[model samples]
Target: MAIQLVTDQLSNVLDDTLRSQLVGNFKEIEKALNDLDGAQARLNSDQDKINQDLKNIKDGNEIRDVNVQAIVNILTKYDVPIQIVNGKVVDTTKEGE
Candidate 1:
């Protein structure tokens, strides 16, 4: 069996001082719910900002990909073989060829 506080049992408690304390408990519960609602609103706002920032990051990545493709296209137009060694771009074109 579970212990539960039914409304009829609460009404049977005839002490005026004890009844006043119960009213205060309801007020505290209401305040807590209000605080939770406010926090949820702030979380929702932050989530929207985070979503927009993620979209911006995705857009930046696409722009970077397009730029890299353009550079590749331009580089392919030339016949000079290029090499990257030790974090440096080196022209590997032979003088005789």
Candidate 2:
């Protein structure tokens, strides 16, 4: 039954080959997953920084609005002609007119 022995040997070899390929594929998948995790971490860090920057910008705009209102109030109290030209307050009052 040498043919039977040879058939068994062929089956064993095929099984070994399949196991090796599967192991290699699993290793590649693990590496890809690790790379994706690192990329996700970087993206999260970038998003946090962007969010902080946006918050700072919003805070700065609110402070600027408060200061602009204060300036308008002062100008109005002093009876100065306040003219807004191109988003800027221009004092149109002249001394000794």
Candidate 3:
């Protein structure tokens, strides 16, 4: 009878130890998951900002092209020869001619 009581106590202690270890491991896993989620959020935010910046750059380029075309038209109207070379406008009218 005494041995049976001792075995029961040992079994209960082992069960408690296993439960505690499992709880600790779960807590660690939860923390790691939370950290990963935070990192992903930050990455998403950065990507959005980069996309917006690219759009802004495209819009600015379009505006610049419209302005350049207007200038070219005005120059043509005045009989001032101009050429666009490598995205730059160059006046081709000779000063002496």
Candidate 4:
């Protein structure tokens, strides 16, 4: 089946050359529009994947935070000799202090 276009219905009498050129221009525009539409679809799919990845990371972070807090609470409750030094948790238990 052929793509029916409005220019195809035009009477190609004395203005056949001009009408043919117009048809070529219209075909080029249609091709560009199709390419643009395809790019938009691909970008939308990529964005959806990125959003899902971000959501997974956020969920993992929440779980990690809960676990860290639970450990901190237990250590604090037991009065453990743990201290943060230079952003690291260190055990301060010594033979005599």
Best by TM-score: 3
Query: Model 4, 42: alpha-carbon shift in Å?
Result: 0.7
For each candidate, the alpha-carbon lDDT, in order, equals 0.71, 0.75, 0.78, 0.78
Please give each candidate's TM-score: 0.64, 0.70, 0.76, 0.67
Instruction: Rate residue 64 of model 2 by lDDT.
Output: 93
Pick out the ten consecutive residues of candidate 4 with the lowest summed lDDT.
Answer: 1-10
Residue 26 lDDT (model 3): 75
The residue-by-residue lDDT of candidate 2 on 1-97, one tens digit each, is 1111122333355587667666666777777779889999999999999999999999999899779878887888888788556768887778887
Q: Better model by TM-score, 1 or 4?
A: 4
User: Which 10-residue window of candidate 1 scores lowest in summed lDDT?
Assistant: 1-10
Clashes of 3: 0
Q: Model 3's lDDT to the true fold?
A: 0.78
- lDDT score, candidate 4, position 72: 63
TM-score of 3: 0.76
